[model samples]
Target: MIQLHDKQFVPFISAKEINFAIEKMVSQIEDDFFDETPIFIGVLNGSFMVVSDFLKLYKKPCEVSFIKLASYEGTESTESVKQLIGLNQDLTGRTVIVLEDIIDTGNTLEELKKLFKSQNVKHFKIATLFFKPDAFKKDLKIDYVGIRIPNKFIVGFGLDYDGLGRNLPEVYQLKEE
Candidate 1:
């Protein structure tokens, strides 16, 4: 069990389980991108662990970059995304993959898609480690998803609560009060 803010204690998604999920996600990506050397764009902070593990399993040649976006305060969704750090690479005519730790409202992903389009990227794909189907508010297709989880505040594997617990090896849910 792990302890979180508000004196919450809950079991986390085990590291072994996370590894299994990553393996599956990587296999799917490899099959779809077998012929192309695509550019992988990892959403910062929360996605760092997932992206790192995924890249290690990626057999093909590819480049990696990061873009930072923020939209959460504590366990609540703000429904707004702010790009804290911008992409520095030129994405024109490039096959790009956007990696996210979790997808809830879809606002962040939608905004990213528009941004990439404006930069003239030829193709864009999404790969998220976690997805909340019930909380999804926009109609955007996700190319790859690791797991479908209920709407909850999660921490670990780079996901955090108030800048804590991000380094936990597995994912954890906040305990109810």
Candidate 2:
């Protein structure tokens, strides 16, 4: 168990498990885009760690970029997304893959569609390290998923609780009071 500020969390996903999931996801990506050079667009802050690990395992040639979006405050989602950083790369006729740390309510995913709707990319896919199917509200398809988890608040491995436990190598689910 661990404490971050006033909340206590228990060990959830291990670091080794996280690495294994990432490797598996990379293999799937290689199968689909082995010949084509796809550009990876990581959702920033949370996706930094996932993107780093994914790129290391993916041997195929690819480009990388980031778009920072925010939709949470403390342990709850604000139910809205705000794009803090915009994509500057030209995505015309290029295959683009978005890497996300986690997908819950899919509010961020909706915002992403709007942002890229005008980019005119040849193909676009979404890849996330963690997914909460029970909580997903959007009709959009998530192309790649590393792990399917319950709709519970979690921290660690890039997911954070008020920006505190993001640096932890393993994941921790919020403990009941």
Candidate 3:
């Protein structure tokens, strides 16, 4: 159990579950791109933990880059995408896999996809540790998803509320009010 910004939360997903998911995702990624060297574009801050664990488990040659986008204010997403940091890579004729911590509304992912398309990337795919199918409103296709969770305000494992609780090893869901 943990508390963030006056909201109490209970354990939602354990670290063991996260590790198992990571292993499965890594195996699939390795098999899918064994013949090609792809560029992994990590969605920064939130995806730092997942990206690190994934790369460690994925024994293949790949390039890595990071892009930071912010859409959250406190526990709620503002739904207005803002680019706090941009991708510095050329992104020309490269196979890019966007790694994200979670996909909720899909607005940020959609915006990123559009931007990457304009940059002339040869290919693009989205990989997320968690996906909220009920909460997603966009019609975009997520290439890979570790787990599906309900629309709950969660924290830990690189997900945060008010910029806290990201260091926790497992995930927790906010308690009902």
Question: Which prediction has the highest lDDT against the true structure?
Answer: 2
Residues 1-177, model 1: lDDT tens digits: 677766464765789988998899999988988988889999988999999999999999999999999998888878888999999988888889998989988888888887787887777999998999999988889999999998877899999898898888988887786
Instruction: Encode model 2's per-residue lDDT on 31-81: one tens digit a residue.
Output: 998889999999989999999999998898999999999999998889889
Candidate 3 lDDT over 1-177, as tens digits, reads 677777899999999999999898888888888888889989878999999999998888998999999898788879899988898879788889999999999988988887787888777888999999999999889999999999988899999888899999999998987
lDDT, residue 92, model 1: 87
- Which candidate leads the pack in TM-score? 2
Ranking by lDDT: 2, 3, 1
Greater lDDT among 1 and 3 belongs to: 3
Model 1 regions more than 4 Å off: none
Local distance difference test scores for all models: 0.88, 0.94, 0.89
Give the C-alpha miss distance for residue 161 in model 3, angstroms. 0.6
Clashes of each: 0, 0, 0
After TM-score superposition, the amount by which residue 58's alpha carbon in candidate 3 deviates from its true location, in angstroms, is: 0.9
